[model samples]
Every structure is written in structure tokens, then in C-alpha cells.
Target: MQAEPCDQEEPPSVLWGLDPIFSAHARLYVRDILQMKESCQVPGIYFYRFHPIFTVDVLGTVVYRRERDDFFCYGVDDGTGVINCLCWKDEQWKQQNEHVKSAPRSLASSHGGFNPVEQLKKLQQAQRSRSQLEIGDVLRVRGPVQTSVQGQREIMASTYYKVEDPVMAVQISWMLELPQLYRKFYDRCFQMQESDLTDSAQSAPALLGRASGLLKDFLREKAVERFRPYDLLQKLVPLIPDIPPEPSTQQEPTPQSSSKQLHQLLRETLQLLQDEGLVFRKVISQDPVYQVTELDKELHRVTRDIIREDSKREKYAEKGCHVLHVLSAVRQRYCPNVSKVVIEVVLKILECNSEIISTTDSHYIVL
Candidate 1:
């Protein structure tokens, strides 16, 4: 499917907002996974989002009881693709135990000759109080999103609510359906291609039918788009610096400038360590190599001072550089995440300052 426009600023605040909400205004760090939602927001006026990827943990009410007494869940979209209600009635957190799914062992389980209207009133009241929240209100939620054959798209939410309206569950339910609706388009694409790929139209349907039922089942099970991933973006959005705490007179760094800073810091730290005898530079493969030996000597050094300044006290005297040791340790942990191509690109940028390293050599520029 072709990439479509992502509003980036949709309601329920799908857009990841600035960190640290100021005053009383709401701020967000939304995700589509219930597990992430719980980890993110603090207790206050906050929003949560997730999809059906986690149906077992979220709490919601029994919104619609079908003729067979099956329940349908509903809740707020709350971004992060999480719908706090109308989730987990059919599939999410499947009720494997027959006895558990039978009913709660409460008074509602017993069919007394009670008035239907009175029972409804009590149910609504309990929902409002966030007690026995079966069919309305709001909830604190977390988890992933996905669809079920038995239910419309649902969220595996953390919190449930019994609020003032019946329309919300239905409305949020529609919002949660976006991913599945998109998936449907993919299925349509596959279907349209199937018959054309085979010479025998009779065998074509059967051949294409070989696609895994289990895959389909898993996709449905994980059908809700509860998470915000770059994969969902149709095109590359302009890269902006991460939001900083409060505001400052100085402008923030752009991506290009930030990358340049990293290059400069690496070169400077390397030079400092080399001068301090922390790094024994060797020529290997026609490039500088380094070894770290003094890192063990400064285990007790104050980290902040070693990084930028030196201490004057006799007991806390300045020590040899151990930044190379740090560089080595960092290389061990994170070298795999970065591409060699990126390293080469950065080295080329550094090569642009060739007067300091190689006044006569142009061959070193190719890195």
C-alpha cells in the first residue's frame, strides 16, 4: 500500500508532545503498547493509549452482551492506539478457564427476581464510582492494539472507567479500527493478485489459500495499532532536536550541527587522552589506533571533574585521562547499533579539517 498522510497532530493527541507538562495543561508521551503507557505517565490528569497487543491486563466494562452472551468492549482512543474500554471481551486476555469466564461470583451472578431497571441503575452507579466498571466511564490504560474476529478493534487497557456517556465506547471503537481497515486493503491487494498469478483459475484459489491461517490469526490478534513507530509515517518528517527542558535564549542544535558536535567531541577527547598518556596511539591499517591503560588508575576520580575540569585539593588532585577507556567500553557496547558507513561519513567530515592532520596528503580524504 502507498504511504498516506499522517496528520501528525490528531486528536487524543497522537502526536508525541513536549515533555514535562507546564502549568496544568496536558502533555503527552503516548505509545500504542499498554506496557509502555503504564511506564510513561504519572498519577494525575493524564492520557494513555495502547492497542489489543495486550488484552489480558486492561480493565473495561461489558458494553454489549450479544444473544450468546458474548461481550464487546469499548474505550477512549487516548492516542497510542489504546482504547481503554470495549477491549478484551472476546479475545484479548482470553478467558481460558471456563469457570472464570462463567461470571463474577458476585450478587450479579445470582438470578434473583430483581427489577431490570433497578439492576441497570445499580450497574450505572457502580460504573460511575469506578467500581464494577462494566460499561461506561473512563479508565487509566496501557497495552497494544489489534482486532479480533469477535470484537471490533480493542485495546488491552490498564484502567477502566464508568463515565457519563454511551456514545464514547462506540466512537473510540471506530478510531481504533484504522489499522485493521488498512490491513484490509492489503488483504484485498493479495486477493486481487492471486488469480492472475496462476494459469488455472480453478487451482488459483486453492494455491493462494496456502497462506497461513495462523499468520492471519496472529495479525488479527495483534491487529490494533497501539504503538507509534516511525514505520507508520508515510515519509520522513523534518528532523528536529529533542525538546529541551523549559525555554532558553540560545537556539537548539539541528541534526547536522549535532552530528558535527559529536565529531568534534570525539576528536577532542581522543587528543586529550593521547596527550595525557591514556591512549597509546599506533598506526594500524594506515590510520591511528588507540589503547587504554590509565582507566584502571582513575576509578576513584570524580566523574564530573574529570569530564570538564580538574580538582585542586591534594587528595582530589588532577589525574591522567581515562576517556579512552570510556571510548573502549562504549565501542564494546554500542558499535553494533551504528553502521560502518555512518562512521566513514563522519570521518570524511573530520577529514575536511585536513590542515591539522595531513597538510600534504589528499589520499586520506576518501575514508
Candidate 2:
């Protein structure tokens, strides 16, 4: 009997570098760090879903410690899991340690009414002591992640320091902020354009672009404001080319395969439309219905009016109206189904037309 060949997974595209998050220091839990899948093509790089993470920021208590001549190794736990961190000793601190040892402490104090040099040395020593953490001290580490010889993931510390969090305020803030990051970024899949695919000429992306164009034209011609997936699937089926039977095996494309291809094309096309701000889903449910954004003039009107009215209020007099406040007002007045992303798209259009100005990243004011 012959053995069956296993299907190989495709390597991640180099175009992943174009994504801003791919280069940023991703704040992740120790457990997720340990669980991340390392890229097969690139060593030391790991992926959490579609997001590529090379460097990370972590906060935890030092549960174990080992001292070395040039570096310190620590086991840090942040209520998730423990990971080893290698922190190198600073050369300046090493020189300071030698100077303090060689110089006599009493010699400075004997003449010290107020010696500047002695005070400076004392301050340096205090800082050095703080940097060298004890086993129980809370530590914040930022560095690129790597795998050790024994195949365990570890961080090669670029920057590590002791965090003094009294009354647990820092920890509480971190706990609150991390979930928002996950919700807004980490959990979302990084979308890849059709041009990024391996076969550009006959790839899924080329098909997706064609399908998206067809759907947009259909929406415009029919004046469609709302649509469901099934409503458009029939129109897209003709785009999927029929496969001929193989010469040797005489294998033809199955009905299931054709249906799957049509569905996949529609799915990608819808996602592309959503990204371009042409359409958005009012609700997330088993049966998703899309609203054509361009057809909704009231959405744009309500969003702009809300910003204009709210910007003059005392609450927003300093920074103008915040994006969140605009979202809330638009949802209440215009349409309850309006999303943050749709609101953001509307804001960008209004800004481009010189109807409004961005006071801050999240605040807007009428022109």
C-alpha cells in the first residue's frame, strides 16, 4: 500500500511587513506568548492569528531569579504563565559598582558637609539597586522574543525595569487596557489584499475584485440599500469558471466544490466592500445583512450634525466632540445599527471635504 501525502501549509507573505502592527511591540499575556505559533520560514518571529509579533511588552512579578556576571535571568509570572527573561547588566552600572567598592565611604563623609560627587554617587547606586530586581519585585520587560536551545520561548530583554505599583493601581490599569487592545486589534484578523496572493493573475483576489465590482454595480443600478448574502450569491455563480474532466482520472468539479467557490468569492467580495467603506453590517448574527453605506445620506448628515452640535457644548469646548460621543449620538438619532467603523469612514469623508477638522486623534470639530 502507498502512503498518502499530507497537505503543506503556505508560508506567510513578506508583505506582512507593510502592516504597522507587525513592527510594533505587542502587549500580550505570558500564556498567549507561550502558546503563539512560531513562523516556520522565519526564526524568532511568531504569529497570534494573522498578526506578526516579534517584540512584546509584559508586566509580572519575578518569581525566580538567577544572577550572572554579565546578565540576570528571571522567571516572571503575570497570573497567566511563567516565562524566562534575560536582562543584561548596564556597563555604566558595572563601572559604578567598581567605583563604590574601591573608594572609601568614610573618606567622602569625613569631609561631607554637602559633597556633590558623593550625593551623585549615592543617587547612581540607588538607581542601580532599583534596576537589579529581587525575586518578589514586580518587573516590566520589553524585548524581542526568541526560542532557547532547549526549545522554550524567552525574551531577550532590550529594556527591563522594576515597576513600583503601590495600591495595585498600575496593575488595575493594565488589566483594563489589555482587553481593549484585544478587542480592537489582537483578536481581529489582519486582512490580506488580492494582490498579496501567490498567483496574482488567476488568484482568488482577482476573482474577488471582479465579484466586488459586479456587486457594487448591481447595488447602484438597483438602488439597493440593504442586502443579504443569498440575494447576491446567484448573480456571482456565473463568474466561477467550470472545470473540465481530467484526461486520466476523468474527474469533474463536484456541485459542492462549485457552491463552495461561489460562497468564498461572495465572502471575500463583501469583506473587500466593507473595508472600502462601501457597505457595513447593521448587526452581527447567524444571518448577516449588509447596508450600502453610499446609499445612506442620512447617516452622513446625522454624523456631521452631531459633531457640529456637540462641539459647541461646554463638555467638548476644549477638544471638540470625541469620536465615541459622535458614535453614540448618531446611533440614537440616525440609525441604531450604525457602527464605529462606519462613523470613522464618514468622519474621514467630512474632513476631506473641509466640512470638519480633527482636533485630536479621536476628536472632531466643524469647520
Candidate 3:
């Protein structure tokens, strides 16, 4: 977001665009829900507190699900802002509950959080198909108040999108929507075979990406998020540890034990990363030497971008993040001699040689 100089008596330039609406912090995005603790008080950044948005996964059957509140949609009207229209596809869940398990107010928060009145009204709505509920149909809903688009107020959809079946929709929201981004990130860890480290172009931001953003957020979150193949790839690339260009070694060499180890570890960690699902942007290719394939190089680029992106976030700040972290960790876990090369490659990530950094790609940011 760009801001121009203001006239006399005007506010600082920080008050413009998404900067004011989203502060950076290690965070995990599950489905549409974003989970993160405020890392710093960035001026003009929105939401000092962490808020979760639960999309209406199964609205058709559950629209009839009412809450303690009498209103059909949980009656939250934020003055003139957007309203969230939520539908619950309750038919399946209602049946899924053990016969002994009567419909509790809100899933686990048995005490309150879920209003029976609201659930009841939603049930009626489901019966009426008022919020556009249909079996095997998906609906895009907004949040903050229950009857979002239903109301005349302007509302941004924190929860919007459609899925085919209720079960699939729930899976999409719980695992695919927001969390899948990191899976693609983890997948990039293996962009090259376990043998591509000898290739010069394979290196990307090899360390910083491993240390920040969504990956970190995933490691820190209490819940597991989903993975979407495409979005995950797009978002994950930026969070990897892409490095600056290394002097070309035209004749590629064979992989060493250290190189193999790096690939093996990277592959394993990446798989674990998929399991971890949601995470911050901090990333590093624990074994850069083994991932020199063309695919690995792209992974490297993404890692660098995400690392930089996380740093620019209000919470990250540009300090105490470097290749040393990954190398040290690698050394502690396995080989000492190999980490030296890794250390060198890592240095390349931050070495701002615009002359060496590729200008071929439009997406790459040359610093």
C-alpha cells in the first residue's frame, strides 16, 4: 500500500491501506479463520485482539439451527459496516452426534458462546432455505453479525465461498481454505529431488523463510488447518528461503552425504510441515545443496519473498533473523562440515547483488 505526503495538519502516512487493517504476527489461517496473537502495537494496524471467523460450513440443513438469540441470523449489526450471513448445514452434524449426545448449545463451549435461540432460528431458516441453503450446495457468507447480506448494511465477507456437500464443505473450511497454503509451502521444500543441491540456481532464500510467518503461526497454533493445492502453492512460495544468485558451477557435481542428508531432512520436515498445516512465513531449505532442480529454485524464490514479506509485517521487524539460525540448527542435528557450505549459500540469500540477482522474473523483488 502506498501513501503520499499529507498536507499540513494531516496524519502520518501509516494510516493508509491494509497496513492499518492487518498487522503482522506469526499466524495460522484455518479455513477462513485467522489465528494469531498481536506481536506489536503497529500504529493504524487493525484489530489489537485476535478474532476467529467461523464460516457457515453446512448452511442448508443447519440454517434451521437456531441460537439462544431469537433472531434468525445472530443479530449483530455493525453500524454501517458489512454483515456476515451464516448458514449451518446441520442435517449431517445433527445425525453425526451420538444418539446420547443431544445438540449442545455451541459445540464444546457447552455453557454459552452458542445461543440456542440463534440456532433454532437458523434451523427455521434452513427449513425455509432463506439464506440460499440447498443440499449439496455451497454458500458464501460474511461475518461479525448473523444476518449480514440479509440486512441492508454494508459488510465485507470474512466467510465467503461455496462447497458441494456439507461434509466436504466442513472439510474445506476446517482444512482446505486457509491452512492449505502452508502445505504447498512444505511441498516446495521438495521442489528438487534429493539430489539437486549441486546446481547453483537451486538456492533461494534458504534460511529466513524457515524462520518466520505462516509456518511459524502453524507451529504455534492449537488447531490444525486445511490445505488448498493452488492457493497453498502461490502463498507458500513467498514464504520460502530464496537466496541471491550463486556463481554458476556449470558442471554439476554429485551429491555428498551432507547433501543427501539435507534432502532427506528437508523432505521429512516438509511432510511434517504439511501435517502442521498452518504456519508463519518463516522458512529455510534445511538442505539447499540437494535441491538444485528447476523446481527447487522456484521454491527458493518463494521462500525469500515470504521471508521478506514477514519481515515487513509490523510484528517481524528486520532483526535477529538470518541464515545462521538454520545452519546452526542443521549442525546441531547432523553434519558439521556440510553446514559450512549451507552457511555460505545462506549468506548469498541476503547478499544484495542486484548485478547477480536475476532480473528475468517480474515477480522477483531486487533489493
Candidate 4:
């Protein structure tokens, strides 16, 4: 198979031109799904409280398989977490699955040289053949993740494609879909790795683990709502007790045991806490700050009310929303007892961490 080239000299700004009715789904790691909790008010909608959009794109390797006369299920792991994926029978997919399973393996392998046209064709072909994937085969699935009858979360895939390299697939997904603040934090960690620490006595993972422990302890002790990574690291590093010499007579601690090992620990710790739903990056600023995941469900209720109000306004042909209207709705529905100043702070935090966008200072749009 050979892919055709586009005749247009310029690329389209939007792959499919701006149509308010159409929006691309978010791509997420399997770990993302595992971290969510069920919505308190909406009985059937699981974890509807976490993200503004419910649909997601998940990438992972198939670890288990189950097929029925009418449906099929596969367990997939993408480093962080594992999710059970269900694909209900669709005739079109069944046909594609059959074709993919029966196709010769030779067509899937690379030829001598890199051919953009050929590579594109192979990818297209791989899409059709995804249903034939074996254990360990990596795949990227797009669909709405819902809790099954058993209360286990599973993706009802609308479509999926074979991934040639799982590592590259995960890296690409994280780079493209992770929040800007989180991405920058990860990049800084990588840059720190490329520093003189590479020549240190401790391995990178070991240093990361130690640093994560120290940062975690500090966050717990301070009980602050949020703090910059650099500032936290500066304070936390001094408190990290120096490692005792094994012989008790050594002149100095090993390089790995030195405070220099704290390089990426703060961010690494934040990432871990985020995964466990204990903490999250309060992405309301350029420098990523840390915040604890609140236990109260008030924020969730306020968010849902705001979204409901936004939807009602959207039906009126309004292009943007006023922040005051949302804040008023929040106060009326969920926080009648809270102060105006407190409500404003909550809205600003939501604007930063949640998907809501600020069109102007007081106007907004939900992503």
C-alpha cells in the first residue's frame, strides 16, 4: 500500500474546521483513569467530577484477552496503570479484525529504507489489523471510559491502532496531552538528569526515590495549599539528613548520598502524589505549584453547577461566558455559606487547574 500526498501548499489550521459541535477527545495514560473517583450527585456517571470532558484516548500494551460471541475484552498496561478495555461487537470492526488477524506478518515489518508514503500506508493498514493484536502488542485506544456493571472502569473503544513502539507511544501521548505545567516540570527533570549528576555515585532512579521521600515529608509537614518547586527544593534539601558512612570512618558521604541528589525529587514526588490522587499541580501559574487533593466534594458540586449553567448559556448562542455568572451560580448552588472572597479564589483555582479558560480577566470559556 502507498499513501497519497496532499496537493495543498499550506496545512489546514484545524484538521477539521472549527465546528462548535466537534471537539477532539483528551488522550490520557491508563494511570489517569485509575485515579478518578465516582461523582457524588450523578449516580451513573463515574469520575465525572475530575475532568470537564469524559471521553479520553488511552495507550497501552494488551496483557489479557477475553472474547465472547458478541463482545471482546482486553487488559492493557501502560506503565502507570492497567485498564480493562471492552469493544462491543460492531460488524465493521469484526470484519476489520478478521482481516487483520489473517493478514501475513511480512507486511507489518519494515523494508530497507524509510519511505514516508510506504510508512503512512503501513500505519493505515495497521489500523485495520489492530483487532488481531496478540499479548504484548501495544495499542492506542480512543473512547469513553465508563464504570462497568461490576464497578470496574473500562473503555468502550470506538477505535484503536497498533503502536510500533510502546515506549515512544507513551512518550508522545504524555508530551502532547499532559498539562503545560506538568510537561515543563518533566522537561526540567530531564535537563537536570543531563547535568553533572550523571557522574554522581547514585543512580538516577535511586536519587529520585530519596528526593521524593524528602519532598513528600516536607509537603506533609508544611500543610500549605501550594508552593513553588524551586522554593520547596531549596528548603527541603537542607533538612535531608546526610547519609552515615558505612565504615563510620569515611571522610565524606558518597556522591549519591549528597544533597545534590535532590535534583528532580520534588517534581518526581509531585508526579507520584498526583498519580495517587493525594496531590496535584495547581497549574494556575507558569511555575507549577503543588496542592493537596481536597476531600470535600463541594468543589465537584460547584464545578458541575457551573458546567450546567454554561451549557444552558451555550444554547442561547453566547460565544463566551462571564466569570461572575459562574461564580454566582456556584454560590447559589453549592457555597451559600462561603464568603465572596473565598468564592473568587476557588473560581481562579478552577480556571487554572480545571479546563475552564479565561477569554479576558472576567470572561471565560470551558475547554
Candidate that would win on lDDT: 2
Better of 2 and 3 by lDDT: 2
Give the poorly placed runs of model 1, Cα more than 4 Å off. Answer: 1-69, 79-137, 142-154, 163-367
- Against the hidden true structure, what lDDT does model 4 obtain? 0.54
- lDDT score, residue 194, model 1? 30
Residue pairs of candidate 2 with colliding backbone atoms: none
Model 4, residue 10: distance off in Å is 44
Off by over 4 Å in 4: 1-24, 43-50, 93-128, 166-367
Better of 2 and 3 by TM-score: 2
Model 2 lDDT per residue over 86-169, tens place: 999888876776776787656766775766457778899678877799988999999999999998999999999998888888
Alpha-carbon RMSD to native, per candidate: 24.1, 13.2, 21.6, 19.8
Worst 10 residues of 2 by lDDT: 3-12
* Ten contiguous residues with the weakest lDDT in model 3: 45-54
Residue 188's lDDT in candidate 2: 54
How far residue 88's Cα lies from its native spot in candidate 2, in Å, is 1.2
| Candidate 4 residue-wise lDDT, 1-367, digit = tens | 7944422211122211221111445555566576655444343333311222356677777898888876678888866578988766556655655666666656645554544445555765665576656788886788876887886888888887666773585656555566563333321221123223323314444355445555555565676656666776565454233633232444754457454545545556556556544555434458666555442345545654575467556452254556566657765776443334444445555665655655554565566
**Each prediction's TM-score versus the true structure:** 0.20, 0.54, 0.22, 0.36
Ranking by lDDT: 2, 4, 3, 1
Candidate 3: deviation at residue 106, Å?
51
